[model samples]
Target chain A: MAGLLLSPTEKVFILHGVQDDYRSDGRSNIDYRPMELETDVVSHASGSARLRLANTDILVGVKTEIDVPKPDKPDCGKLEFFVDCSANATPEFEGRGGEQLANSISNMMQKAYHSSQAFNLKQLCIFEGKQCWKLYIDILILECGGNLCDAVSLAVKAALFNTRIPFVKAALMDGGNIDLQLSDDPYDSKLLDVGSAPLLVTLCKIGDKCVVDPSAEEENCSVISLIVGLTGDRKYYYPKDADKQQSVESKCTTIGMNGPGSVAPKTLKDAINQGIVAAKSLDEALGQALLKERQQNIGIKKHSYGFLK
Target chain B: MPGPDLLSSQGLRLDGRRPNELRRIRCKLGVFTQPDGSAYLEQGNTKVLAAVYGPHQASKSKSTTEGVVVNCQYSMATFSTGERKNRPRGDRKSQEMSLHLRQALTAAIKTELYPRSQIDIYVEVLQADGGAYCAGVNAASLALIDAGIPLRAYACACSASMAWRNGEPEPLLDVGHVEEAAGGVVLTVASLPNTGSIALLEMSHRLHMDYFKVVLSRAMQGCRDIEIILDKAVRDHLAEGWTKQDVVTI
Candidate 1:
């Protein structure tokens, strides 16, 4: 995390602002900062996305590899999360300084997606018990403003939505060996079922009140923050499809707590509820943005404005 | 001796680049606000981001009275390459690259003015098509400039490979991934083009002594060409950042 040094008076101002439901940047407790997102930016990976939430910049690239499924979960695929806190973000992240923070974020993502309801792994299965597609979600933190978990999870979901797995035909050969043939046409691929992927929301508890998407200054004034991961609604991902609009309620997948301070049980419960609301809105906006971009890119070459714009 | 078909019959190298031609270099400075200076650069398919912090107070152990201490860290993203990497940093290759970056940047920096201070340069390679080290150096130089740090001149790096065409050795400038994979001799040179001083030079594989000068000179030329592009970009950035102040004479 990037350290932000604020004076006692500044902290008091922010704390009072949170109590009044109006933050310094004119955003309410539930309002998030403006974000810029672009998907399929990295050509080398199967899918990639870059998201900038305020000053926190996150780039995620998802790579696919074929591997044998575990004996216990033979019908499912695997999703592995890796977070790399680049030294470019801050000097403290140089060498192995950022490893601990990176591990915590990756662990949160892993736990969030561990449930089948949050993400269906069966869609990635190629040969059921024999082979499966393993997705490696590599997240690169370019900058840390605040609320890193939320930005990372959002970028991961966007990248997974952009992932395209090539169509392959597998046949049982001699001695139970599987023969796989891949389609030559690049467009002949299947998109991942990422509509229900989980998104994490960090709710910073400030002066007995919780605020979503805390800025760096606000985070410095806070003592503890609660992270909640909630599954997204599939209806919002695909636009205007009445059949897909069979409203399925969002479910909680994972909960995490950070900072050295303790919180009351009642405050913790309230914060979790606030987090669920924030995640729901965030997921809906992200899905709409992704679908709109896809629509614009249809039947045309996408001119990627990576980092330039 | 020509081992692979790096050059076509029409004297064009792999990736359709003519001899002495450089790859497309697109760059922007001040991409991030967190760091004092940040830059993103793309050379052909290789993309790199660099951030510079300091001329600030150095730690007690690392402080020096003579000149500013230059610290460098070079790390690649795990998904930057074709094969997924387990660790992004703290590896032998990254450490070596960090040291090499320090050497190249130290030559251009005016370190004597900032005694008892330290400047940290961190370069991250987001895509490793080819010539990643060269792109890293170039991007770091831009970031240092963006920080308003004093430098002798722009330190640019470029790579060149050697190939034989029509019984004559032809030097290929700005080597791409395919040419590098062909196992030809690649010469990487970082230099201050205006000052005409080589900061760091590295060569991979074997090349005959007779053709070494040609390759080195070609790489130096490539550096000069890159310097022109970077200088123009800096000027444009400055012009855009500081609009002319309106003055009224009554």
Candidate 2:
């Protein structure tokens, strides 16, 4: 939005397009742009993913560290989100310029994943309040076209899905202190249950209608946008459970409105419902992509397509 | 350090490459549409992305008649290392890296042509296995070329480490994270290989003065090798970015 400038007539053009339920890019009001995702791209981190939604590029890496659980929530593990707005995205993001946007996105993700129904932190617990795995989810904003919140959340979830927490080979609790041994073998690890991970859907309000996946020009034309974080169903992430009667339903875990303009209660409700629908379809596609990637790594070594492809 | 050795009896490094073999360098130019030029490069497992903004009008305060001002920022992802980093940039180490990157890149760009202009180069390390600085320089070079910035030559950077194989000191090319952590001496060199001149040279962990030349030469050789690879990538990118045009000679 900083570099992109649209004239009054250009803004009107976008507004009319949104009102017609068709966008400048020929997408419907509820449709998202084509997205490309790949998991396990970074070798340094335990789990990593790169997601490119049109021109917005996001790379997320999940690093697991052993630490003592908090006294208040000893049974639960820690999930900390750190967002880095790289200058590669835009010059305005250079140095500490992007810190404000980065903090807002990270905080939104933190609030979204805070609910137990959204992400089960107990799976990261190692020795029942003594020690647990602390996942440091670091999201790097490499490029930004628009709709950064949605891209970051999707990449985070994919990285979490690819994350593997090593099993505790040995543990010893000594008066107020604990020592734990983790297996170094890469295979001696457990995959996280990220099926219920939250996905954020940003609906930009242009004119009186809402549009999903707004481009940079559309973003500048809109005065306000709502980011809805919805919980994904386990059956979507794990296809093995797809055969069973679907019991889990999509739920709104968090709702965040960004911008100076405000939304009416009626429009907000409709936007929330629209977000839920968009999230489900997005989740289904992401699940299929992750499953396909997992199957590809079954018998042979994965020739990583990191940035080469 | 005592038990795990950097080199085995077969003269192979820990990552299975020969002492003088550089890592597999795979690179692509113009990976993004936002920046004037952007590239993504992976040297072994260390991946880097670089974006070049402009040689446009310099800011009022920074404007000068001397030449183009080269501004560089080097940052690594928080999860790029074995341990999660607290911040991506602005740390002492990354700030030093930023200066070093500017030093290396400034030597290659033709600054005199763009008087009172500024070129901003931003390098982001997505995964730093080792020799992250070298990878950053190489990626930035590609991005600069993609941006169509005139340069003296291709700026390439590489690192070398001394590994003892069968009681002999063997200079290893493209040091990896494990070897760097093995208490070995690492010598990093950023050079314009075609110009046959060094732009920046840095060494960490003391090494014998007698073995310094061998390690330095290894790193320079690595730079030359990397330059060739980057040149090919640039050529490939140009061919891809071009679209067929019908001849119009009226």
lDDT on C-alpha atoms for all candidate structures: 0.91, 0.89
The runs of at least 3 residues in candidate 2 whose Cα sits more than 4 Å from the true structure, single-residue gaps closed, are A242-245, B1-5, B164-169, B243-250
TM-scores, all models, native as reference: 0.97, 0.95
What DockQ class does candidate 2 belong to? medium
Off by over 4 Å in 1: A169-172, A240-245, B1-4, B242-250
For residues B133-239, write the lDDT of model 2, one tens digit per residue.
Answer: 99999999999988889999999999998877666778889988888888778889999999799999998888889989988888899999998899888888777
lDDT tens digits, residues A48-104, model 1? 999999888999999999889999999999999999999878899988989999999
User: Compared with the true structure, what per-residue lDDT tens digits does model 1 show for residues B33-71?
Assistant: 777788899999999999999989999999999999999
Per-candidate total of colliding backbone pairs: 0, 0
Q: DockQ score of candidate 2?
A: 0.58
Could you tell me the lDDT of residue A9 within candidate 2? 89
lDDT of 2 by residue, A131-229 (tens): 788999999998887999999999999999999888878878788787778898998999999999999999998887888888888889888999999
